[model samples]
Target: MSPSVAFGTDIDERTKAAEQSSTDVLTAPDVPWNLVIWNDPVNLMSYVSYVFQSYFGYSESKAHKLMMEVHKKGRSIVAHGSKEQVEQHAVAMHGFGLWATVEKAASGNETPGKGGRQRG
Candidate 1:
């Protein structure tokens, strides 16, 4: 096969792949955000920590840290990712008696991994 023919074939394949990638990106919905629970007067610190563990499965230390942030700082990014996900988290937080709300994560900071309370 001619060198030009081989190179042209590769270019065509690359272009097609790029087009597919662009399409996927364009069609993808923005990931739902998170509902962060702020510290409140009603819930005990330990109870908040327990809720984090029981509901979010965060480790004890991690849950404690977040709880402290809420207690001391008054708020923290307790949960994260897609709007729907955050809404669900907010509802769950409410059920647990923690205040929560959904918001878009800042740009250039995608891919929030798991960070919930510890398992039994």
Candidate 2:
């Protein structure tokens, strides 16, 4: 005796196929990655702003904006590019004592340290 599992009986074939494939869904577009900096108590706000200005060569005002976003928003995107470029930015942020990581962009183009502007 066994419970029934039918093809067209509400248990769709697509669900079964998805279960078989242990891969991510393909909704992600051809978007560049992002460098994200999470706020931490260790790094002073001034130093964080300075890091953005020094490493990314952002202007003083632009750096302050990104730093404020990271401070108030908990996290802010610091760079945008391919996965490799974003990862390098993350590593550099780590060197500056800021918590950082890289991930696929949520939107198409959103850069933090670069003043929320996308660079080609």
Top candidate (lDDT): 2
Residues 1-120, candidate 2, lDDT per residue (tens digit)? 111223345544433332222111112234367778998877999999887765665667878888999999999886666676566556656766789988888764564544344211
| Residue 4, candidate 2: alpha-carbon lDDT | 22
Tell me model 1's lDDT, rounded to 2 decimals: 0.58
Q: Where is the poorest 10-residue window by lDDT in model 1?
A: 1-10
TM-score of each: 0.62, 0.66
In model 2, what is the error at residue 88, expressed in angstroms? 0.8
lDDT of each: 0.58, 0.62
What tens digits encode model 1's per-residue C-alpha lDDT throughout 54-114?
5555567877888888788777776554454556557657766788877776764533223
RMSD in order of candidates: 17.0, 17.1
The CA lDDT at 56 in model 2 is 61
Model 2, runs deviating above 4 Å: 1-31, 113-115, 118-120
